[model samples]
Target: MIETIFRTVDVPAEHRFEAMRENMTNVHAPAHLSSAHAIDFSAEMRLVRLGRLCVWPATVQPARMWRTPRLIRQSDPEQYHLTLMLRGTKRCMLTGRQFGPHEMHMTDTSQPYEVEVVDDHGEIKMIGVEFPKALLPLPADQVNRVVNRRLPGQQGIGVLLTSFLTGLTRHTGCYRPSDGPRLETVLTDLFSAVLAHHLDAETALSPETPQRTLMLRIRSHIRQRLHDQELTPATVAAAHHISTSYLHRLFRNHAHDSDHEGTTVAAWIRHQRLEAARRDLADPAQHAIPVHHIGLRWGFSHHAAFTRAFRSVYGMPPRDYRHATCRPAGPAH
Candidate 1:
């Protein structure tokens, strides 16, 4: 299951310092400054973790200003941070670049950066989406040029980017693991569109960037064959009329370049199968089907292998995952 972290900060006149300090610690804020307010001040931040990505929404009130000092630092497992302002104003500076308001910017946590939040008696609201750098298809040099720099959000691709983000934030919960593949596609397109717009090089992009078209096709094919126990690189390559070497190249180019990258195709197939099995296990409509049958239906030939894979992926064996998901909230008393 996905994990979500929600935090709220309300600082009365007397305890404002304490509240601010606590919030800073929570966000791993490098440094902060606040002005004395006659009235109370408050802020709210919500963080949602989806596999390798994280989304955060922040709101602040009573016109207090917060800044990260030069010496402050922060780190994360994520590769990039995208910040979009929903309401009010915020300015972030990194590598001598600045971004604010309707504009969007990306930050590399490995480097030192500062964000200035200015309320000025008004409210401030912002949303931040963080994901792995590998998820983006752009070259490192091109990506570097855009990072920490404010991109225009006034017309054309900017409008599309804004609309997509708004919709994504509002409707994320409606998506299920079965929908993960689709969501990943949408994210790829949105990121591509945004980058192409900023670089003024949309026309320069190839008809099939490996990360965009090729990987997408491979993932779609994998999802369709999740129920086929014989699915393998050889079979998949044959289906696509491509050589196994070509298939391996595609996976290596799109996924990370780690030792695990060699097994990505198989890993992807297993992930989809596990997701399908989990759904079937929790679904009352399928309660009549034996767990072993459900595993078989999702392409697991060996019950033992399925049990081990299910446990490794979901932190429990099939029966245990089903029982927990199917359990009642509590006794009525």
Candidate 2:
């Protein structure tokens, strides 16, 4: 049930200026449109919504647009529209810079800002993800810094987000209706992760923000070392430049009502190691490998310990789970 919702308009030569103006308004926030040749203007807006997020993919010709004070006085969506240039160029007065392909910028529709597309023939394409301003859940000051400025989308989470969005737009029909909540959560979290990385927000966000941020970082670190026999709380904390006590506190804050009731940080490492072991056990390429060898690869100290841990989590030992999941080999090739 991937829903594809789109809007398009081709402003006639007779009413190009006026019609283009209206089209631009609906594409984002209301704005004033001015162009020497607005005639034969063309624009198309493709939107895919997973819950409240509107993935507005836009393509249009050259024009000068502004979110003026007067326009804000009349109407405003108070949304943050993050734009990534797919092709062509743009000059923004707010940031006083030019954005070329693959670079991103954020525009707060609630504020007064102006931009001009640089394409002489008036053809440009880009993706704009509109986030409800009230729902961003980020520090206003930090958001402002990244809003008008160009942010890199070629590295780290930016790369992941850019690839996700590129694929998302290309495969909008593949998403199921039931995927709304999960997709919405992914978009929000990815957005938060990107902006937080830019803002160095681990220290700037609220108490809970740092805790959540730390856990995410810690988890990534743990995943990379699931096979390390010495991946204890102390080692994990030292690698992250935090104390062992503080590391335990992170998982605690993220867990049960009583800090003592939830699984300790050390236990989480063990569980993750066992989970990795089970995955290796199920992998067809590793079928010839011994089960105990797989356990040792994932840091299990003994055959019995790995078996017990695997059974506790999956209601069966590693070998049994693999037997149940792995299909028999068919005729060669």
* Candidate that would win on lDDT: 2
**What does candidate 1's lDDT look like per residue over 185-275, in tens digits?**
5555666667776787666455554345445556657777888888998898888788889888777665632212134677767777888
Ten contiguous residues minimizing lDDT sum, candidate 2: 254-263
* Lowest summed lDDT window (length 10), candidate 1: 254-263
lDDT of each: 0.64, 0.74
Question: For residues 1-333, could you state the per-residue lDDT of candidate 2 as single tens digits?
Answer: 234444334444677567657655775778878765565566767767778788877787777888888889898888888888888887897668988888887888878999877675568888888888666668777788887787778877677567667867886765567666556655666677788888887554445544554565676688788888888899899998999998887787666321122368877787778767876777887888889999989888899988998898789988888899875456786
CA displacement after TM-score superposition, residue 17 of candidate 1 (Å): 6.7
**TM-scores of all models?**
0.50, 0.60
